[model samples]
Target: MTVHEVHFPVRFEASVEDQPGPLWKARFDRYWPAYRTWFLRTATVGRPTYLDCRRAMRQHMPELVPVWESLVDLAGGGDVEARFLSLWCPPPYIGGCTQAVWLDPTGHEEPALLRNYDYAPALLEGNWVATRWLGPRVVAMSDCLWGALDGINEAGLACSLSFGGRAVSGQGFGVPLVLRYVLEMATTTREAVRMLERLPVSTTYSITMLDRQADWATVFVAPDRKAEVVRQAVVTNHQRDIEWPEHAKATRSVERQSWLAARVAQPGSAQDIAMALMSPPMVQDAYQRGYGTLYTASYRPRSGAIGLLWPGSEPWMQSVADFKEGQRDIVFPPPPAAVGST
Candidate 1:
């Protein structure tokens, strides 16, 4: 038996709000049905208890508790809604992404964080969001309804997450919420690294942080080990070694990492580095496998600007400093079968 080939159209939206309100409500209403179905996929495994979820929030990320309550309120405040929003040891998820820090030797381009989010398009939240949920403004792509996939904060810190290419799962929060927490709480790469060192992720993930000070670090966090922080720039699906060979092969993680590493070692502008992500070896077009390059996100942490690019489409630009609200209908024309995947 085999799976049928399929592809999807993604609707990328830029939404702004000071707090949870109409935009959040409409989004919840539009996607909660699908989200509910996905959330209950682990019914047989027994999802975490609501009390346990709240306790985890209180114990680890207490600052986000109020925001959780607000999101739950907007979600109708059911037991499942509360638990799912906590992102505390919920259902397992894995995604493909390529991220790197751009430091130009020519002194022409400001430091930037370049990312390509490769995933099943239908599952992509598609919300390029800007919010003031926790005081400082955050501009990011939304995941888990409210959590960030990759984003920059008003404090000039930018963060992105990629699956650590391991199957291990344990008691900890999802990486999406942790990314959100970092954007809200940290002001620099050093501060973000320290925070990730102590935060427990439910599974393995590689988190890359960049700041306006031209500082950068990549933290490899997992459920089964202590966090490892390195000053390396490029990150893909794995950590120091390839732990999952099948996933490594499927995502072409090693090849993509090597390609980007070689690319980063050269002299070029930040835009040149970001544009590389759209080409072969960096772009993954295996939509049939549930992971394909959906969008390229270039974050200029020095100025808090986001450039959302497609292969042939005009880049949709936004910023944490002054976010514009609009929507873009996105079409993911398949890229050529490349030498590697992101």
Candidate 2:
């Protein structure tokens, strides 16, 4: 899909939080700055529940109160509006796997990074901690979707988010914080899935988690406080293995997923199949979407490695980064013993 040109100035810091379990929630509390209102409005469908997520964030991260207050003030009377509203509604049939390829139409350009800094070297004084500057290297959109978007934590657990087609009309789910929370709190995929399943959030979304040993599951949450887990396997953009009114809706993204899945080689790593989904623009839905979409991401739990490919670009941009594509890969490592086990 041709995405709205967005320049994301992001930073990834990997460290244990001050408190043991609050890592995910707290990070959402702390670094809620870079989150753009446009992403929240359009992407999240502008639910008041999202605001509740922000409120929880403020409660947990009192230190960022000033900043949060400023953001709220910027919004004036109510929730901040999103500048960009991109595609959502890829078919639910586009199943996910322990090791699968990822795709991000956005975050594919040269990073117009204003500035970046990390505090991992200085032992974390609190629950928040970050890794060293892993890369000063230039990367493509993988950073938004591959790097910071989803990846494994130092403890070897991997996490990723896929769309969930459910109606969400509340004010309390913070998407970025939720992503960050998984990496921060859970050391294994199972733990991460549990955290998401139990979280009393009102956001309409789903998450896939894999542990160091390849155990994987999906956590789906709705505005009704109804959360369920698809044990052993999961997928998204719609409910997996079940039909929901929202999931059944036909959209171009759904068509593309079906088209890609048919051509993908099965009984192989999902990551490989995902990469296959990024077929050349000639065969892709790029023409359907004037903006064009070609980037995809895949994760190999066995190797604790991630493979990224950009078929739309010249020479086919490919590299391996940590689960989080926020940083560039200097050297791709060997795959791990199991698919999802870090």
Candidate 3:
């Protein structure tokens, strides 16, 4: 049997609060340094101006404009900080993920979303957040400050994302903030799909959405192509087909997609699905290559509960209604060099 080459240790924390106040400001203070680094990584190539960001937000995501302004003030109102909060037309980044909508054959277990978020630990924000920013409560894994990686809203809408395998870039909002907007506004899987259609996303990505009404769909969106909402139970890194062979190969997208398709077709407990995500194909161990399975997330929309799972540990459970602020110290097995490339 083969495993990893080294250990990547990280801290995972959770925060539940209503509307930005003290906690939100404190979060900005803590993560601003790292967020600034990520926002400026490609600064040599001329980025957008603060006015450009605000104008784009007001034009496309008008409802979030107020929230954006408030967050900017909370972040100390620096020009760079305001621009990054807008998340408009940011540089493209890569990540690998395997996500599926799992349903019980006998209609016993909760209709759920299972996913493995694969990315470099150093780049991971690693915070589980529950907040009531707009109206309904939203519980999500935070990415770029206020952006959501995967989340469930109080209205019984849950969704997760996988980086669509492509190297395209364009004039649009970063996918993370787009996802945050969806969770904040949309209430069902269908509505989430509609929201994706009108939004100008900066890059390619696959979004799997599930609602408590037993409705689900995987919407494939990209800056360079038309967005398609497919009746897919599973999605891994690509769209209808692998347009980027190198990325698809490195992430084992095809293999993971096939494995998950079969895995979800069978009847199993929620634990079974989560375990599958934590296993091979669905899981990646290529930390040295800037990709790895950081966590396996199980979101039950009906209950608004999220099971954050990691190997060698019990799941840390959270919900939109019953969120308990906590933290986990995780030490992942050291990864091999370019584990995804093998």
Which portions of model 2 miss their true places by more than 4 Å?
Answer: 1-55, 58-148, 232-234, 240-265, 269-271, 280-294, 312-342
**What stretches of model 3 exceed 4 Å from their correct place?**
1-3, 44-46, 334-342
Please give the lDDT score for candidate 1. Answer: 0.87
Worst 10-residue lDDT window, candidate 3: 333-342
Q: Whose TM-score is higher: candidate 1's or candidate 2's?
A: 1
Reference-based TM-score of each model: 0.95, 0.50, 0.94
Error of 3 at 30 (Å): 2.5
> Taking the tens digit of each residue's C-alpha lDDT, what string does model 1 give over 239-275?
8999999999999999999999999998777777777
Sort all candidates by lDDT, best to worst: 1, 3, 2
TM-score, cand. 1: 0.95
lDDT of 2 at 73: 43
TM-score between model 2 and native:
0.50
Which tens-of-lDDT digit does each residue in 239-276 have in candidate 2? 55334453334323344445444443234344334444
Estimate, for each residue in 1-342, the C-alpha lDDT of model 3 and write its tens digit: 334647778899998877888878887898899878878998835788988888899888898888899999888899999989999988788899888888888988888888999998888878888888887899889988899899899998998999999898998899999999999999998888889999999999999999989799999889977889899888998888788999999889999899889988887877888888876667788876877889889889888878898876767987778889999988765333322321
Q: In every candidate, how many clashes are there?
A: 0, 58, 2
The lDDT per prediction is 0.87, 0.37, 0.86
